[model samples]
Target: MRKGRGRRAVLAVLFTAGAVLLLGPGAGAGAGGPGSVRQDGERPSFRLRTHEPHTITPDEGDSIPPLTPAFGNTGPVAAPLGVALRVTVTDARFDTIALDTIPRNCYLAKYHRTLICEFSDAVPAGAAYELAEPLPKVSGDYYAVNGSYTYSVWPLGDPPAHTEDYTAQYERGKDTAVGLKPVAMSTLKGDGESTGDGEDTGDGEGTGDGEAKGGGEAKGGGELRFVSDGYADRADWGIEGIKLRGRIGEYAEASIPEPTGAAQRVRVEVPEGTSFAPLTRQEREGLPSEIDYCTRDAEDGNIYCSNPRWYVTLRVRIDRRVEGAEGRISVAEPGNGDTNPGNNTAPIKLEVEDGPTSIDRWVPPVSGFPVEHDVPLETAGSDDLASPPEPSVISVDGRTGVILLVAGASAVTLALEAFRRIRRARNRGGRRVTP
Candidate 1:
């Protein structure tokens, strides 16, 4: 096999995340019921499946179909929590990562050689998260190179599988970690009418018991909004500052309650090519709590969650080979004093794909988010993924980024257009031509 040279494989990772509200109905919710803060509630089992085998040609303009591997909350009613996911590239010339739908929070970093993905929050119980992004990458060449990555997930804080700091994965032994859609629901519907918790148009007033009994509708709701710059074709360039917005509000009839650490634990998720950046001193001051960084030890970088009144915003920047983002985020914490736990957690559906973007938006944000989302990259039938390809290097001139390869030549030549032009003219004129 020809040893194709390209860019260095900077051990990269794709991330997914979800929130686990510690105050499960099974546990006590009042101040002293179950030690809501320390419960750790039981961690749920995670099931990860690969997509079917697919072939493609990678080129500059061709947007290749992104490999979508999905992880499901196959466990029972456990507090929402984050999981650790890993993708092992075993086999092509190069590959890129992107997310159409995103998690509550996700961060991407270069591992030794492979991508180590971790989520900020937890995967919801019995919730199915499929990556909403189509994940299309155009071909840079005509070679039908096969690319693949093996994905695995484990509970974020699981014993022998977790670290105090997420970045600890770099120095310490490999530790695993931990969406989307854009689902905007104003309120629940019963028999096609807004029968939330309150409201009566003179015809008949809505009662909590009636609405809850007649239709299994939720009392309160929220929205998930994500903005991403389209994926990049080149390896040198990257996408930056993808915006993640999560707003927790009530459906008109829903009652408001006092804020608690639960409000501080609201989460935001991101995808593989994206990761959270360090928070600024000012941003940190306005944040609610450090739930995001609560688990991290000294050396491990961490960012805390905020206790916002109704909204939280997170910024994720592009690493490399990132096209779009797709994922979901919602409040999974125990509600302040709600009789019905039905509205405790709500899932939104969202997905974003490749599109034209402004030059200014090309760079994503420098901030990072915790893992937690509804985005799941999926493949139907049996999960059959192509083995990940090997890494390569690409050399470009500052001006032209042009490289010339001579057949059977040992030396690889890299030169700019100016150098080539001067050389060409010199060869033709042989000192006869004057500048």
Candidate 2:
């Protein structure tokens, strides 16, 4: 009888110890349980709010503000150490706006058209996490509605940094969805036929036939002008594993609208320390199959494309990280009725951050990307520096200070602009930014 009692006591003691370790000290002491404490690994409870543009005009292919989502911890017990924000495109008929098309921190989901962007950061209680940059570029016909954007933010095991396993955090987080609304044509002016206010030109001169033609089938015989397609004001470079490298290596192309006459080659000149890398078969699969042949010039280190079909891509490579590397891409021969020769040649200037170190790596080119469908970044002006602006903390709801994380060059620019605008509103008078 005594042995039986001793065995029962031993078992009871072991169970008590196990429970204490799992629940932590003072378990279920106050109104809330020990799970509410950080030491006991409090689970983050949060809320999410989504913000999208009120309306968009298909004719205006220019980037609108991004699909901004905000999040904050709603639970009083525990402050989340870190979290991740994921924005997914729910509906988009055209593949251009798909997530894979987005540049950084984004990839294609299991469902082909679905795009998913995951950004990780430290999110404290009472503070909201948000993203603003690389404004999303969308295009659709008048009265045509694309799909909506769905967003969710959750705590991560290792956040402020990305981790492979974060599924459980999602279950404990929050989510919401917003629709992509295009402006009604009735509000626009003039007939759609005229290239006026009412026209939803997929490009500058499109007829809303679901095509963005520069000088091709849309408007025939205006002028056979050949210009560099998709030229940006500035190209910024980023650091790679402590090395100074092209964050998004420069890419340039000249889109041939239609056959005006016999074909001529396009010339792309590289700086002394840089060279042009041609697209491989896999990379060229999705691109237009119009390139007859491309070869690099031995003497001048220039690239020439002969009989390029719809368009030709020239991916720039930095053979040596030299300072002030500048190059140009242009049509070899001017065509008839080429009125705008100024835009014919686009210059490529590689801008690096303020300080560049000796860490440089040689990355081999497996494939090249087309400009039309690739992710693009832009800023208010070309004169701005490539590096992210200094950090600034803004108080939201007069509670906690929300610190903006610099994700990329474009994000840095847009976030700075957002702050400037907020300050401007306050300075104009006593303007209160509604939380």
Measured with C-alpha atoms, the lDDT of residue 63 in candidate 2 is 26
Give the per-residue lDDT digits (tens) of candidate 2, residues 197-302.
1121222232322111111112211111111212211222111111123533333333323222232444656554444666667766765555533557553566
Instruction: Indicate the residue-level lDDT of 196 in model 1.
Output: 32
lDDT of each: 0.32, 0.37
RMSD of each: 29.7, 27.4
Native-vs-model 2 lDDT?
0.37
1-435 in candidate 1: lDDT tens per residue? 121111111111100000111222324223311112323444453333323333332332333344454545535644344544443332221233332222223333343223334454556665545445422222322222223444444444441211223353332222222243322222121233333343211111123322221111112211111111121111121111223322111000111122322232333344454455444678567766622221111333443233224333444443323334443333333212333334433332222333323343343334332221211223212332222233334423422322122211212122233346556765886657557
For model 2, which pairs clash? Answer: 290-309
Model 2, which residues run further than 4 Å from truth? Answer: 1-41, 50-53, 58-65, 77-81, 93-104, 110-120, 132-143, 158-435
Worst 10 residues of 1 by lDDT: 11-20
Model 1, residue 309: displacement in angstroms? 62
* Strongest candidate by lDDT: 2
